[model samples]
Target: MLQGMRLTADKEHIAVVLNRPKYAGNIGSAARCAKNMGVERLMVVSDRDYPQEEIRQMSTHLAADVVDSIVYCRDLGEALSGFHYVVGTTARLGLARGPVMSPRDMAEQVVELSRKNDVALLFGPEDTGLTNEDLRYCQSVVSIPTSERFRSLNLSHAVMILCYEISMAEIGVPERFTPKMASSRETEGMYGHIGALLQEIGFLNPENPEYWMMHIRRLFSRMRLSAREVRIIRGICRQLSWYLHHRG
Candidate 1:
């Protein structure tokens, strides 16, 4: 910890979201890591109820509060819907993954965002990292650079690295005001409307809207659109729909 450096991001607003994690121990270890770094929220997205004792055993007393307050969510949307910004963690990359950020760089950005917004660090299952569908919900993706020999990292280790970088990030008083961006729920709604409108105009394949939409998501994710901006885009989409309908 840097001496006299104030931790800027609100711990209450920062969350570690586990998407379909398979191991109880990993969840516990993640809880431990989050607590260690002053993050207090943990959300698990899965239907199955993991073993509490096993979870607590690994988390121990240090993170017992994290485990105790863990919010169990049914799916990805419910897990992420309330978040103003979500960062997905992945080991693999492709054109579909969109632009990737290193953990340190992401932490720097997130520290600022968390001062006024809700942010989620989404980690995938231990077997496979977040899928393309999961990445769709994320505004940004982070990949930890590893040797070519082994690109993967243990799930808990990934959480620890992200949390540590974020916690240790030293910042002077920010000159610019960081506004609250659109929530995942609101952003998804905007995408849905835009997708329908694009297909209506024959710009996207009606049979394969998602393929084209991935590119669109990348374009807008970079914008970090606020609720007002999202509404503006959707409002234009609505007007376009009306104009198209009235065209003779």
Candidate 2:
């Protein structure tokens, strides 16, 4: 039996989000992985009921507390609402999907981002991975390297690999001070404000707003904007709104 595995205060900031998971065993195993890595929070986005007994059985003693405290959300957006940096895991890739990184690279980046922001690692269902709509909420995507013959990994295995990488990441003290980055909520508000301004300026087509907005999101997500930068952008939006009103 695994003993003395406990959650820490810092681990609370990193949440493992399972989106529309299909099986109870996977959920339990994932919870076990989270506990093993010291991540206490587990967020589930599922509209259906799960087998509680099986989940507990699979989780064993490693993740009973985490499974017990799982936060249930109606959708991916709600699950990721409070996070500052959201990383989605997927096996597939496409042009519309944003940049994809290997697990190791993503872990290093996540470790740095987690310094000042609440970070979330998002996993899709057992069958189909996160849909395009779900990926829209994520700033980055990570794929675990596997043999080409059988690329797909089990849900719990994926979680374990990611959690292990994150746990092994060596966070070093920075020589210079840096400002805190904006939270997901704040950045989302700025996007909304920008969208409104774009509509008013006749820049975004009401019929196809996504074409431009997706690229804009990708651009900004890559920049990893700080809180001060987000505020500056919001200020710019406010000025534009004032200009439009005065010119009328």
In each prediction, how many residue pairs overlap at the backbone (N, C-alpha, C within less than 3 A)? Answer: 0, 0
Clashes of 2: 0
Per residue, candidate 1 scores C-alpha lDDT tens digits across 125-155 of 9998899999999988999989999777888
RMSD of every candidate to native, in Å, equals 2.7, 5.2
Candidate 2 lDDT, tens digit per residue, 17-113?
9999999899999999888888888988989889899999999976788989999988676677788889888898887777799888888777666
Q: In terms of TM-score, how similar is model 2 to the real structure?
A: 0.89
Candidate with maximal TM-score = 1
Poorest 10 consecutive residues by lDDT, candidate 2: 1-10
